[model samples]
Target: MRLTDMAPGMRLAKDVYDPNGNVLMRSGTVVTERLVKALRSWGIDEVTIEADAEDAASAMLDPKTAAEIRALLDQQFSLSNRDHPVIQALYGLCLERALGNR
Candidate 1:
């Protein structure tokens, strides 16, 4: 798939292959400019980008909805921490749940 084939908000994945068509990039490597160029040159614009398929397959969730869910979960689960990391994680969880990603 070429970059042109990619839709708005679509995630991307790349596979770096040697001359033998062997996979070079190990698992979990995110896309970068160099990688995109290489893939485009090869006429392969889209590879299987790793998304939280679990999340993507579920409903689409907005940030506002995610926040509301987070607040409710925090209250219900008794997650009292207000620190950045904790809050962020909780926020992410809430987003996932709201999005049906979890």
Candidate 2:
């Protein structure tokens, strides 16, 4: 996709690289507006991103709505076995992705 059409919170489907072939960012890194500006300055014009079916719906949610959902998720996760590193990691990733509306 064209970098111009990208938005913050979109995940990269592939690694990005400089003209010299040095990796700029790894695959799965979330796109940010600041990163977009930097990439534009570096002459990058396109990127491959994950195709999310719910992205359009999620984008409509305001930060406040996202926060509310996060709070609910936090309450639910409190009952889980957070002592396990794997569960903690999973919850952390879920928190980041679910709260990406910010």
Candidate that would win on lDDT? 2
- lDDT of prediction 2: 0.73
CA lDDT of every candidate: 0.53, 0.73
Per-residue C-alpha lDDT of model 1 across residues 1-102, encoded as one tens digit per residue:
234433344344435565678885655565566666666776563355444542453335665665576577777657556567666555554544455543
Best by TM-score: 2
Clashing pairs in 1: 1-45, 55-101
What residue runs in model 2 are displaced by over 4 Å at the alpha carbon? 53-102
Model 1 lDDT-worst window of ten: 1-10
Span of 10 residues, lowest total lDDT, candidate 2: 50-59
TM-score of each: 0.34, 0.51
RMSD of 1: 9.8
